[model samples]
Target: MSAATVSSSPKITEKMARESPAEQAQVLVKSRICNPNFIFSIFSNPPDSNYSKLKYIISSSLTEACNNSVLLLGPRGCGKVAILELVLEDLLEEYPDMISVIKLNGLLHCDHNCALKEISRQLCQEHQLLFSKMASFDDNAQFMVSMLRECGLAHKTIIFVLDEFDLFAQGKQLFLYSLLDAMQSVTSQAVVIGISCRLDADQLLEKRVRSRFSHRKLLFLPPSREDTERLLEHILLLPTNSSFPHEYVTAFNVKLLKIFADYKFKEIVDTLSYSDSTVNHLQRFLFSTVSHMDLKSGLLSLENFKAALSTIQRQPKLEVLKDCSILELYILVCMKRLEAKEQELRNFNAIMKEYKSIHDTFQTSNYYARNVCLRAFEHLLQRELISFEDNRGHGQSAEFRPVKLLISRPELYQGLKSYPSCPVSSF
Candidate 1:
């Protein structure tokens, strides 16, 4: 066959045209070198402020120990991993010859053991030739110790960044304990940086492991509204432009940006891109739902907008709630109820009573109460709407209090005031 005849195909041209605009845009964007301006612009001035309080915690921990282990605690998309990457970048620039960084995200694996094995495998691959002599150590601990020795001697420091570290700790606590013990023996020249979304005080770290990382507990505060807005502006603005169209940016639409911006910069971008792909999903809902009416009204008062939101809230598919879990729903209800009362639910018992009243209104059976409440409380704590003041015992019976309930769905609050009991079921 002639090369020209084979190359000139109408089918291929048609296929290219059929590709989505967003996908085509992505392909074009990915084909070019990443724009440094775009990357840097997403970050605000005094760059440290963009990081919230985490920047200080990370810097303080690194300054304290040449061989430190830090547990960054926050919910998913809260930017624990991004901050670590930024720290790694800084470390590499400051001590290129002395530092060797390895980052492993635990969520990629099937379980904690698999995550550990993957990390070990990656470490082996990276420094295979250097640790060729210590190949006899078959177990992970021995292997890690041998690798640490090689790294310590060859480089001044070695940092292992474990993102989603909770995945590894969930069922494989013993394995983590062993890993931490092994890392502790690294001649004061190695460190481990662990990141996780949940920070159960009792389960945050094993007692022995906790002792090792006590001084390095870095809590990442959620980004402020102002910081979130600035971050969103950076995200929406193209590198070529200093500002985006005002029509494309507004307070009502800004909540989506704020929600995603609460996470790390990279995560915010990933979520935004995902939201863009399903743009119609939200847009459809907006038009068919309250947002559509609110837009038409032209005077989007907070109260009216909230009322519209309440109507739309009831119509969400059950599948979405299932994916979010009963506990998540329970927490959502608690937040709504508290907002309805126009008083912050500070006391643990008081919050529980409010939750129980809603549960009773829903007629949740006795068998379901404990499990449902536990799940809801845990989810709320994970999302930073509430926190555990004390854990009377291990596992599910722990007591918790609202640290601060950041409820964005103001409409749900208003709706609950009229029908407090089982407001979810009422509409």
Candidate 2:
């Protein structure tokens, strides 16, 4: 395929570059192991502002061997988890024997008991300590505290990293508060890092819980266009062989079709920071291009890339909807209905009323207070499932422009009808 076929190019999304194991290790750039730019895709400037801050925090915390809490905040697909992994790498090297790092994702351990049990399980697995599973929350809580305290008294550094941190913010504050308290204790040289997609997740904390995490906070901004472009280039370049040229043409049916984006595929690269659809589609194109690369020529020609592209079947992305809460699903139902009616710039109050109407219609016992509805609205906004325009107005007259549905509204609602509490069950 040539450039004409993919004129509107899209960026390489997180799923494309970072997650897919085949692409993660092999498909990306042939850059050397030591190149800092290529080391982290979409991270253009080595030691940029956020990097420097995070590096400094890691260095300071390591050198001091004292308790420190850091909260990393960023939007989805923005690389908060990556930064934490980098920090963990440093820890692995710097204090192999003296430190124990436990990484937990809030998504999987949303329940208070689950989180506690996970901690105990991991500790035992790591050290081969055979302890009976604490059956009760109190027992588990005490078990976790005792283990941490023992580690601290032994002059060992304990690090707990919780990603998707906002989930933990909603339930009982005990786990969070306890972690922070362990960190600050005079005997425990522990560190707690909470990575959240919410910019103001700290607000969800009780005053006491909030106080522990107030020490350090860093927000990772989305990567820029240039950074993204370079990231793709770095990831694409192969030292041994070229899969395809930056631009290529393919023969589709009887005509020559250009399967390219961004003119030079820049269009595809530019959207990396914002669009997941673009990423999903582009990943297929790249994979196809690479697979069709000629072995003897050691390069992928337009013919090879196109032949591969022609065979790829596009798949629907409905997993996002499957992961929505009941409240969030109802909110999506409301936004979708409003969008179907061509209603634009409706404020929160208007959406809330619509949501209630839909909720009541469902004949379910799900109860969402106004605050809960608002929370779901904000969460939906963050996920980019629903988007609204700010009319630059606030208070009584604030007009929130049309709530646009990025995902297939009909499909999402169908998923809801089939399984409303799919994601909530995990919590």
Candidate 3:
């Protein structure tokens, strides 16, 4: 049996190796499209050209061993962090020996004591110093200051990346004060780069803390429709100068361009633009598109895009209904029937009455007791599929409380269409 299995493995390997050149090219194309770094590399900077400004200012500051501070402000998923990271990554590669990076997030180290301890830990790890947890905040702060002074003497540039900077600006802001104060007091070549979603993050700082800050702020905004279109082209269009075979690249690009021109594809892109016009959103959308590709097709299509877009834009209520029990769906259907009759005050009792009428009239099998139906009704209420009127804490029992269907008529119809054995017609 072992010998037979060994022999059969080669057959499997041979079958896998039989994939065509086009299929292999498609695999590479999918990989490139899904690669966040590759996608970010193709990022079209805004008209203000923040990417260049970041690269130039940070690079020049590092080169001169000068201390500088900058804040990056933007809404979440607006590529503020991505742009900064790309610039920092390139700079680190260029000056590997000269640069040492320390990353801190306000979510994790917003407290002054925690920030100090984290600074000590990161500093010790980066410099290969034996780290001992300090017994007090003062000891930790002192150790960090000494470490910064030592780093300066060694001609090393420390780059501090503070994410969610607004959180760190709360309370006494001892973390910000000590950090900015260190930049002024010590001779260390350091760059304080703060990234925050809050546009007014700078204004949150105390006067003492704000005084120490360099006051340079960069604002990031969502990509425009034209920018989003350009991004799509860069992501989906195969580069002519790529290492891929000319025929494969040309063929893929042709197909991609045709897809781009298609109104359906354009509409999908437009819909996404109106929802979340971010690089991250576009990548997520493409991730779904690539997920639908297979060796047989070996190419992306409008159908794949449509399916992916539909998945992303699916209704939450419909999705919830799909996961519901048949009994629960029955309760929903009862509510729907009651709604169709334009019944006022469709409370749990009223809905249960409608359910029994249908059950008796149709003589439906697999009968659920009133208690089971009540439990299902309560579940629907929990999911907010049904909501109670402002009659809570009244003398009436929970069953008599007036409720309304949260879902629309069309949603009920669509949700039931895909549900197996829904028995929607029994109503």
Give each model's whole-structure lDDT: 0.49, 0.60, 0.77
Tens digits of per-residue lDDT, candidate 1, 83-166, equal 555555555565566766666776675254554566577777765633243233245556667777776666456566777777
Candidate 2 segments exceeding 4 Å error: 1-45, 240-264, 271-274, 277-285, 292-297, 300-427
The number of the candidate with the highest TM-score is 3
TM-score of each: 0.48, 0.57, 0.70
Residue 402 CA displacement from its true place in model 2, Å: 7.6
Clash count, one per candidate: 4, 21, 0
**Shift of residue 165 alpha carbon in model 1, Å:** 2.3
| Predicted candidate 3 versus true structure: per-residue lDDT over 367-396, tens digit per residue | 688888888888888998888878564787
Q: Candidate 2 lDDT (Cα, whole model)?
A: 0.60
Q: After superposition, how far is residue 384 of candidate 3 from its true place, in Å?
A: 3.7
- In terms of TM-score, which candidate is stronger, 1 or 3? 3
Question: What is the TM-score ranking, best to worst?
Answer: 3, 2, 1
lDDT of 2 by residue, 320-415 (tens): 666777777767666667766777556577778776665566655776788777778878777777666643434533224445667764356446
Q: Which candidate number has the best lDDT?
A: 3
